[model samples]
Target chain A: MKQFSKTLLSIGTALAILGSAAAVQAETIKIALAGPSTGPVAQYGDMQKIGVMAAIDDINKAGGVNGMQLEGVIYDDACDPKQAVAVANKIVNDGITHVVGHLCSSSTEPAADVYEEEGVLMITAASTSPSITEKGHQLIFRTIGLDSLQGSMAADYIANTVKPKTLAIIHDKQQYGEGLAQTVKDGLEAKGISAVMFEGVTPGDKDFSALIAKLKKENVDFVYYGGYHPELGLILRQSAEKSFNAQFMGPEGIVNADLAKIAGDATEGVLATAPKSFDQNPENKARVEAITAKGEDPSGPFVFTAYAAVQVMSDAIKAVGDTDPAKLADYIRKNEFDTSIGKVTYDEKGDLTESTFLVYSLHKDGSKTPAAQ
Target chain B: MSEASLYFLQQLINGLTIGSTYALIAIGYTMVYGIIGMINFAHGEIYMIGSYISFIVIAGLLGMGMVALPVILVIALVIAVFTASTYGWAVERVAYRPLRGSNRLIPLISAIGMSIFLQNYVVLAQGSRDVALAPQISGSWTFGDPQLFEVSLSYMQLLIWVVTVVCMTALTLFISRSRMGRACRACSEDQGMTNLLGIDTNRTIAMTFVIGAALAAVAGLLLGLYYGVVNPFVGFIAGLKAFTAAVLGGIGSIPGAMLGGLILGVTEALTSAYFPSEYKDVVSFGLLILILLFRPSGLLGKPEVEKV
Candidate 1:
C-alpha cells in the first residue's frame, strides 16, 4: 500500500512540473501603450492606439519577437503633464519595461524623465518639441521629423517662394507651437524677410478680427501661424469675414485635411508645411496597406511614426536579451531600423538623424494636395 | 494710423464675439442658481452634450443626403435644442431633485459628480476623440482691397453673431412677459412662498432647466459652425466662463448674463491674441479673480440677500 501511494504522489508531482514548464514557454512580451486614450486630443491618441494595435497584430501573426507574443497595455494620460508622470509611475509599477507614448509634447517631455530614471525604454511617436531631446536621454526617440525640419522648410518657402514684403507670425503659445514659431522666425529673418507683425493666438478660440485688424493696419502681405488647426481655422474664417485677404501659412500641426474643414473655403490657397511622406510617396504603399488592413486610415502624419516606434522598440528588445530598461534603452540608442518612412537612426540626443519635410497647398476644393513639384 | 491701435480694435471685436457666447451660456448658470440655489457643475457637460447631440443629428442627416445649408442648420438647431432641453430635465431629475432643499454644499458636490459622470458617459458613447465638424457654408464677403488692406467677413461668423443676438432678445422677452416666466421669477425670489401660493415649484424648476439647456444648445450649434469641430468634453471651461458671466452681470438677472458673457468672451480673445496665447487663460481667470475681489456680485449682478 505504501509503495503504491508513493508512485501516485510521484506521478502527481511530475504532472505539476510539466504544466509549469509549458506555461513558462508560453510567456508573452508585455509592452505598455500609454497615452491620452480619453481626452481632447484623443483623436491623436487614437492614432497611437491604432498604430500599436496594428503593430502587435502583425508581430503576433509573425510569431512575435523572440517567440513571445507582444502584449500592449494602454493607459490614459489625458495630455496633462502631472498625470503623465502618474501614468509613467503606474507603467513602471506594473513591471512594463517598454512604453510607447504620451501624445503631446508637454506630457511626453516630463514622462521621458520618469522612464529614464526607471530605466524603461520609451519612444514617442508623436511628441516633436526639439527641447524634449535637447536635454539628451538615450531611451527617448520620436519617429516623425521635428518642427525645426518643417519650420525651416516653411520659413524658407515663405521667404523664397511666396516672397511677401510683410509677414505676420502668430503662435498658439504651446511648447510645440511657440518653439516652432521661433525657429521659423529665425529662418525667415535670416533670409532677410522682415515680418510685419508677430502675435500668438490661443487654442479653441472663436474670433480673430482683432488680429485681422492689426494685420490690416500693418498692411501685412502674408500671415504665418505657428499653431494647431483649431485656432488657424478660426483665424482664417474670421480673416475672410472681416475682409483680411492675405495668404496664410502654418506648420505641420495645422497642415492637415481637417484644417480645410475648420476654416472651410476660407482655407483655400493657404500653404502649410509638413513631412514629405504624404500621398505620391511610393515607399509608403505597403505600409499604408498595412495600416488600412487594421481598419484605420494612415492619412495622418503620425501613424507611420507611431508604427515605426513599435518596430524600433521591439527590435531593440530582441537585440538586448534581458528586459532591463537601461540595457534596452542603450540597445535602442545604438541601433538603426528600416521603417515605412525609411531607414531611421537616432542620434545620441534621441533626435532622428535622417528627416524630410514637404509643403502642401489647400486647393479650391479644400483638399490638401502637395505643392506642384 | 498706428499698427498697435488697429491691433487693439481687432482684438476688442474678437473678445466681444466670444463674450457673446459666454453670456448666452451664463443664462443657464444664473437661471439654475436662481431657481434651485444649487450650482450645477454639470451645466458644462450639458453644453457638451448639446454639441454632440447636434453633431450626431446633423452628421446623420447629412449622411442621408440632406446637404442643403439652411435646411440642415434649421433641422439641426431644432433637434439640438429639443434634445438638450430633454437632457436638462433629465439632469434635474437625477442630479438636482434628489438633493433638493439639501445643504447647498451637498448639491454642489453632486453637481461635480454629475459633471464627471456625463463627461465619461459621453466619452464611452462618442469615443474619446474630437469629431470634425464640416461646415456647410464657406467663403467670406470681402470689402477691402487684398494688397493694401483687405477686410473680410465669412458667412459662418456673421450667422453665429446674428443668431446669438436674436435668441438672446427673444429669451429676455420670454422671461419678462410670459406666464411661466413670472412664476420663475417668483420661485427665484421665494420658492417656499411661491409653493404656498399654489405653484408646482418642481415642474417650474424643471422647465427652467429645459429652457436654459436649449439656450446652451444654440451656443453649441454656433460653436460647431464657427470652429467646425466638436468633442464630448468641450463644454467644461465654456460653462465655467458662462457662469462667471452670469455672476458678473447679476446671477438672477437675464440681461446681466448677456453682458457678462460678452465681457468674458472678449477678454479671453483679446488676451490670447495681443499679450500671448498662453496668457489667454491667465486673462480669463485673472479677471474672474479680480471680479471676485472687487465686486463679488459681478459686472451687472446684484448681491443676493437671504430672505426670512
Candidate 2:
C-alpha cells in the first residue's frame, strides 16, 4: 500500500508538470512561416524565413507582444499549389492562427482561400498577383505590391524609356507567371505597344532552341519573360549561344544571384522591375544591422516585406489585446503601422494603400542600378 | 540559306542535341528492361545523383581555384560515373533482388518507392534550390547569312554530339564482342537457361545495370553542363521523357531508343517552332499515341511472341 501511494504521487506530479508546460505553450502566439522551403525557387523562401525569424527575435527581445512570447513554426509548400493547400490544412489542424507566407502567388491564392474560410490571418510577404486581393477576403493580406503595380511600372519604363520596334512576351503558364505576363501585356497594350508574340513555355524545360529560333525569325528587339530565374537563366544563355541578341527583361522573379551564375556573362544588362530595396533605406539602419549581425542577407526584395508582415501582425495582436482574428483584421485594416518598409497602411482589400516598384538594370555581379526612365 | 531553311536547320540541330542526351538516359531504361523485364523507375534518381555528384565535384574544384576546365570535366565525369554505378548496383541488390519472381507490379512499386526515397535523400543532403555552374564551354559556329538569319551550333552542343556518339559506338562494340555482353544477351533470352550453363546470370544482370548507369551519368553530366543549372526535380521530367523515348523505340532495344530519342526531340522542336511552345509537349505525346495506335510494338520493336 505504501509503494502504490508513492507511485500515484509521482504520477500526479508528472501530470502537473505536463499541464504547466501546455499552459505555457498556450500563452505564446504561434505564427506559421508557410512557404516553399524545397523547390526550384526555395531560395526566395529562405529570404522570407530570414526576415520572419529576425522579426520574431527582435519582438521577443523587446519583451514580446502583450507580454506574451511569439513563436514561429515553419512549413514547406515547395511553391506548389497542391502542396500549399495541404500546408494550409495542416496549419489549420495545428491550430496556428497567424501565417506569414505562401510566397508564390499560385501557392498563396489557394492557401488564402483556406485561411479566409478558417478565419486565420495570413500576410503573404512575396506573392504579387493582383487576383489574390481581388476576391477581397478579410483575412488575406500581403506586405508586397500587386503584380499589376509592378507590371505597369515595367511597361511604362519600356514605353517611355527604352522604346523598341518589336517586343515579345513569354510566361511559364503558372498563376503567378501567366498573370504577371497578362498584366504586362495589358499595360503595354494600353500604352499602344503590342508584343509580337505572347507565348507560354513549360517550366522546367532546359532547351529553348526552338524559342530562340522563332524569336530570331520574328525579329523581336525586346523580350519580356515572366518566370522565375531558372527558366529565364537557360533562355538567356541559350539565346546568347544562338546569337539572338534581343534585349531580355523579366519581373523580380528572375532577379537573383542564381541568374548570373547560370547565364554567366549573358546576365549582363538584364532589366527587372522589383520592390524598392527597403534595406537601403537610411531609416532602417538599425534593423538592417540587426539582420546582418546574424549573418543573414538583407538585400533580397522579399526580406523587408516579410519582416513588415510579422511586424504588422504582432502590432495588431498587441493593439487588439487578444489573438482574435476578426478583431485583429478590423484593427489592421483601419490603421497604419510604421514598419521596416517605412509606413505600411492596408486598404479595404488588404493591400497596401501605396506601393513603389522600380525598374533596375541587373549586372553580371548580381548588383542592380536604377534604370534611367 | 533562306530564313525559313535556316530556322528549320536551327530547330533540327537543337532537337538533335537534346535528343542525344535523351538517348543516353533511355539506354539505361531499355537495357535494364531487356534483361530484368522490370522497369527500374529508380534509374532516374541514379541519373539525378550522378548530376549532383558532378555538380559537387565541379563546384568544389572551382572553389579550390582550379581553372583547368578539361581536367575538371574529366575528374567530375569519372567520379559521377563510378558513384552512380555503385548506386545502380545497390538499388538492384536492395529493391529489386528481394522482390524478384514476385508479382511484377511489386518490383515496379518498390522501384518507385526507391525513387522517392532517393529524391528526398538528395533534397535533404544538397538542398532543393537550383544550383548553377559557370559555363566552361562558350561560343558557337554560325552558318548562313548573318543579316537575315544564322544557324549556329554551340560548343556545348558539339561536345554532347561527340560524347554521345563515342559512348554509343563503344556500347555497340561491347555488346557485339565482349564476353560480359554475350552473357547479358543470354540472360535476357533465358535467365534460367544461362544459369544452367554455369554462367552467373545475376552478375550479368548487374553488369547490364552498371553499364546503363554509366551512360546515364554521362548524360547527367552533359545536360547539367549544357543547361548550367540543376535541381532535384530535374530528373523527374527528364526521366519521364527518356522513358517515353525508350517506349517509343520499343523498350528493350538499344538502337530503337536512340532513334526514338532523336524523333521525339525533333518533333518537340518542330512543334514549338511552328505552334505555341506549350503545345510542344501535347504534340509530342500525341505523336506517340498515334504511332502506338498503328504499331503497338513501337517502331523498331519486335512483336512479342508468347509460348503456351
CAPRI tier for the interface of model 1? acceptable
**For residues B1-308, what per-residue lDDT tens digits would candidate 2 score against the true structure?**
68888889989999999899999999999999999888889888889989989999999999999999999999999999999999999888988888878999998999999999999999998899888887778888988888888889889999999999999999999998999889988988889899999999878888888898999999999998888888898889999999999999998899999999999999999999999898999999999999899988789888888956
True contacts kept of each: 0.61, 0.91
The most accurate candidate by TM-score is: 2
Model 1 TM-score on chain A: 0.73
lDDT measured at residue A370 in model 1 versus the true structure, 0 to 100: 76
Each prediction's DockQ against the real complex = 0.34, 0.62
Per-model chain B TM-scores are 0.94, 0.99
Candidate 2: residue A26 Cα off by (Å) = 26
Candidate 1 structure quality by residue, lDDT tens digits, A1-373: 9999999999998799557646754577778887887779888988788777777877789888887888787899999999999999988987778888878999999999998887888888888778888876777778876767888888878877888877889888788788778888999888777776666766655556666666766677788888887778778866765666898888878866667666677888888786765334687676678878767877766676777788887777677766677777677678888765678887788888876577888764656777754
Candidate 1 — which residues are off by over 4 angstroms? A1-147, A266-269, A278-354, A362-373, B1-15, B60-71, B137-162, B266-288, B306-308
> How does candidate 1 score on lDDT?
0.78
